[model samples]
Target: MPIQTSANSRLRQSVGSPFLASLVSFLVGVSTLLVATLLIDAHLPDLSLASGQPGWLLTGGFLGVVVLTGNIFLFPRLGSVQTVVLPITGQVLMGLLIDNFGWFDSPESPLSVARIFGALLLILGVLGVIGFLDALVRRTPVVGNSSDAGPQLWLWRIAGIIFGMCSASQTAINGRLGVVLDSAVAAALISFAVGVATLLLIILATRTPWQLKRIDDGPNPWWMWVGGFLGAAFVFGTAFLAPIIGTGLTVMVILLGMMAGSLAIDQFGLLGAYKKRATPIQLLGLALMVAGVAAIRLF
Candidate 1:
């Protein structure tokens, strides 16, 4: 629990600002990823792009910067539950739109009623996770984790929601980039490297102190050291799957995995996360989420 509690407080304080935290973390994450990418390329055959790749395809990395910063801003304002769920909902919706329209040179995957119903169920699950029903019963507002509440609360929430949409957009865009590069690993490498450069520029231009190593020294989880590896796996996996499965389906599958992971963390109070026992309401919500995923992808 110290790791979890310390992680949040340290991030806000040590990095000086949410903007710095986001950029610095992204810088660290991408730096870690760049090393991984190089190692993987050396170890594995055919990891690199075979031919010349387009210039525009590289924009996916910048979008990732946005995603990281948005999450950084949202966590303090929205708490863990909403931080994860709201973005997920927005991302799923964006993925659907991208697939249905064939945007970003993606293949068409038309929308259907089952997918819509599934999305609704997923939303229902989100409400349960946040204890929306519990709040209603208690006749109280759902308070976020923030110690301070004021006018900017709504602004942060709105910004958080917008960031969620950006994240979903990035997924789709990166998937297309993967297609262009002809190899997912190549796209992942480019994305991470680009993100690292962008963060580096921001740090210098804004005069943010180099706090990239700060996360490693505190009461942070050992996982914090491996955040880069975790992040690398995700970005690489997104590029790997997005084009092949389409972003909507890819995100649906990813959502299921995330739900399971989130449940485990919350159940065990992993990383010092707030301890919330899995009640029937939460279970039903999870079941609905799974069912919704099935409806969208399988039905």
Candidate 2:
């Protein structure tokens, strides 16, 4: 979460266009994975293994692009906390459904009372964290000025949740791909490769430029360029972890880390993310999110 947030922040700070930032991030991520693939002499054989496999498995890359570009567009408008939390809430919910139905050939973990309770808690957490409840109680719009940005802000928040659902699906697909190829790293590489190809098509179709706009007054920091590397680590980790831990547990752990990291980023304004100190209600919301995940996966 931190890595993704940091990278999004940098792109928002330095890159003018969300489409361009998505392209750059994927390019860097793919390049890094390519080097690793060559160094390890990994047995990718994605083409040979492509036949007979469910077509949906390869869609991870497409979903990944959706998430990357969506996050880029969402971060500034929603702020760091909402950008991270909203999608994760969606991720958890979608992950539950994925596990229950064995979507994408993932292992089946049917929903139970505990799981439903967890989902409810997660929804409550989202409402609290996004200040929806507070606004409702106060009889005000969540974003203030219902006549103007209020509706737009709600729209972005909804998009963030949908993007998160894409993220959960991506994780499941990539995990299954990793198992098929017998190499998590190779799966990540293939995912990125497809993402790059998809992004190129989008850029061409939209006529988006390769040049990034300079948002910072001074020269860009070196760390900003490395967000993709961190993203690679995350993709590889989730791909590797999901099959072993089950999608529910995998999403739970990732969400826990993301919530904690996003809070720190919001409070400290790390990675050029907007600074907004978490309120007590927001902290309580975080606690609820943790409990919700625990109920889903642990209890």
Candidate 3:
């Protein structure tokens, strides 16, 4: 009886550890990203009065490298869901603030009703995808059960919302910053640096020893990294493109791309995670997300 009890305890602990790790990773990732943004913002030159600022471009490039490295380390711990969800949520919320308050740029920028509705629809679609994925996991015993439940799932859902907001906020940041830095490569570099610095700081504070043993030990799927690079490009590109394309349009298109990319990534089980094949419901949800984007673009 004692042995059975010990085994059960260990089982529960093992199940719980990854979830805890995911949460920690999510927090660290977001915090680091924000810090990187701050770093970029601080180093930005005033290009309003002057035409071009070459130095700011250099700084932005450096930052982009930092952000990319940070993701390389952080994503594994957070898992794909939390890693993607948190930032999406952040983008949605921050995007609204930046658009309405114009905190990062001219205060004259105003929020529109269409954009708000579009954001809502986007959130609903994302939730639908999450629910669909959760259901798939539950139905497939082969994949095993997800540790997420009750409040924990909600927390992750909220994290997704934050991630959305982060995406939007980044659009604003990039738009404003572009005026000074004026180059996508520069902005990407700066964002990367911020990402790296934040992760390094958190690792140091947590006193977590860096482990490289799992690096090459996991799946050798090179395609997964391609998705990551695409994601990185989308993120950095959106920031650079937002100024020309407008935040609403940029986000809508990027979200469309992300939904499609995520489906492909999740379907293949590319990241050494569960393999829950996408179902009709998920496809429907993806369509809805695309529709939401279209609505925003047209209206």
Candidate 4:
């Protein structure tokens, strides 16, 4: 076989699998992030875990894998908007439930009537964002090949939603860990390290080859390597803010930002995702989400 010179080329060479491409990309990004986090932590004066909390709280790293890997899988089929929206639908709903009952050791911030309405709005907003309404109006087939495409697409979407819920739970878990550890940085570091460890276990269990050297093969988009950093930012942000605002509100705020970022990424075709414009309906969906977020926060 001819030598593969680029990242995409290598991915294509791997049995022509996009999943493998995404997997490799994610692994590279996360590994890069773990190393960077360690280097930065080395300079901090106190790096010990302060709280003698249960170790299971560190599972935030595994949850990061679910969210990031799910994104890579959905990016091709759902594009950017649906990829972000559907999961966020699950996120907001779970968040509401979490706050209502104080799940995962988060503080009890019961869902009020405003929050219930906000949850409904968030659901409708997701459907609108993904154009389910328009697709229904036009009677356009939502997916393809009826037999295979429809089922497969639904499966992926469901998986994405489940991943979204796991991510929400992970944020709450990490936040609690932060309470125990007394440092957001420590919480984030633990999550990233755990995530790296989990990925390594997965690779070993599946007997996949370690492709560390491939990152140096040639030029690629700089953003492809920022997965770990993005993950760290999220874990740290959630850890730092979850206690102050409660997991539900924190997730809503994050969801708002996610919506804005997803819209921009799709609109501009950023990061190699397909370019798709935000239609008037989708814009309405975005407005609804903003309103819902506001309702959840202000009321």
Give the better candidate number (1 or 3) by TM-score: 1
Q: Relative to the true structure, how large is the alpha-carbon lDDT of every model? A: 0.69, 0.79, 0.51, 0.68
| lDDT by residue (tens digit), candidate 3, 75-185 | 544555455545655666565566567555523335678777777777667655655455555674212124656786566556445445544655656555655565544
RMSD of each: 4.6, 3.6, 10.9, 6.0
RMSD of 1: 4.6
Q: lDDT for model 3, on a 0 to 1 scale?
A: 0.51
Score every model by TM-score: 0.78, 0.83, 0.58, 0.76
TM-score of 1: 0.78
What's the CA error at residue 137 for candidate 4, in Å? 3.2
Counting clashing residue pairs in each candidate, in order, gives 0, 0, 43, 0
* lDDT digits (tens) for residues 174-197 of candidate 1: 777767656566667777777877
Ten-residue region with minimum lDDT total, candidate 2: 141-150
Off by over 4 Å in 4: 1-52, 68-86, 143-161, 212-218
Which pairs clash (backbone N, Cα, C closer than 3 Å) in model 1?
A: none
Model 4 TM-score is 0.76
- Best-matching candidate per TM-score: 2
Q: Write the per-residue lDDT of candidate 2 for residues 156-218, one digit (tens) a residue.
A: 889989998999999999999988888788889889888889988988999875665555467
In the range 119-170, model 4's lDDT, one tens digit per residue, is 7786677666667666776897654322336678888778878888887888
Candidate 3 residue 117 Cα shift, in angstroms, is: 2.8
- The per-residue C-alpha lDDT of model 3 at residue 251 equals 61
Clash pairs of candidate 2? Answer: none
Clashing pairs in 4: none
